[model samples]
Target: MAKFRKKPVVIEAVQYEFGMEDGFVVDGRYYDKSGPVPRAMNRIPAIKTLEGRHEISKGDWIITGIQGERYPCKPDIFAATYEAVE
Candidate 1:
């Protein structure tokens, strides 16, 4: 079992790359191998994606769950749905 996250977290859009390739999802997201890079995640790698939890995938915004788990969120719905919290 995993711990539940209750508070809204700050998330940012990023460019996803599997290696020598580069491209879209515009929002100017990309991966820079020169420095601190984000870990790749998928539904298989995600600790959640069950029930009402957000789905994780490629070309999605990386959101930090309440308990500090990082997961992917769809771009369009991510913009239309959640508001940034202070």
Candidate 2:
């Protein structure tokens, strides 16, 4: 007989904007900060709260059960992030 295991789900962040690669643009005209800002994709997902349970969705930030760390990424990243688990 063969044994099977359930796979875990992974989440990531995604930006939602008009027409911009990675949904981020660099313009000198824009205001500048003292230090370089870590450009975050506009569509990138962070975290969300629902009913009473916790879950991860595409383009949604999440913490990996394997390492117990959280990060913001896109849906594609999420898919790749959990590819190993799945």
Q: How do the residues 1-86 of candidate 1 rate in per-residue lDDT, one tens digit apiece? A: 99987574455444333442222221234433454445544212122333433323456666555555555667787778677665
- In angstroms, the error of model 2 at 57 is 10
TM-score of each predicted structure versus truth: 0.34, 0.24
Candidate 2 segments whose C-alpha is farther than 4 A from its true place: 1-58, 65-67, 84-86
Q: Which stretches in model 1 have alpha-carbon errors above 4 Å?
A: 1-59
Compared with the true structure, what per-residue lDDT tens digits does model 2 show for residues 41-75?
A: 43232232232223233434344344444434456
- Give the distance in Å from residue 60's predicted Cα in candidate 2 to where it truly belongs: 1.9
**Top-scoring candidate (lDDT):** 1
Worst 10 residues of 1 by lDDT: 20-29
Look at candidate 1 and give me any clashing residue pairs: 15-29, 15-30
Candidate 2 Cα deviation (angstroms), residue 51: 28
Under the 3 Å rule for N, CA and C atoms, how many clashes does model 2 have? 11
TM-score of 1: 0.34
